[model samples]
Target: MDSRSLPNSSKSSKSSRAEVSVKRSPVEPRVSTLLDVISISMGETG
Candidate 1:
């Protein structure tokens, strides 16, 4: 993992306050990739 891994992971799973409208952004592609990695990490740990 690198420096970005932390912030991006946190941002994606942080809260539902802005979650709805947040998906309309163009950055969703990259963010989704990061979320995938986070999901794998969570699965492995659990």
Candidate 2:
């Protein structure tokens, strides 16, 4: 029981970590693009 539970907990933790990373990546690109565009516009104006 202990052995099985240990592996299961590890798998769940890894999956949760992967899911969080996947969720974060989509938002990062959008925020990054917005910052890039704003910088470019400021550069042109300045």
Best by lDDT: 2
Per-residue lDDT of candidate 1, residues 1-46 (tens digit): 6998998888877765477557657688889999999999999999
Instruction: List residue ranges in candidate 2 displaced over 4 A.
Output: 1-6
Best candidate according to TM-score: 2
TM-score of 1: 0.42
After superposing candidate 1 on the true structure, give the runs of residues whose Cα lies further than 4 Å from its correct spot. Answer: 1-26
Model 2: per-residue lDDT, tens digit, 1-46?
Answer: 6888999999999999999999999999999999999999999999
Q: What's the alpha carbon RMSD for model 2? A: 2.6
The TM-scores of all predictions, comma-separated, are: 0.42, 0.60
Cα displacement (Å) at residue 21, model 1: 11
Cα lDDT over the full model 2? 0.97
RMSD of each: 16.3, 2.6
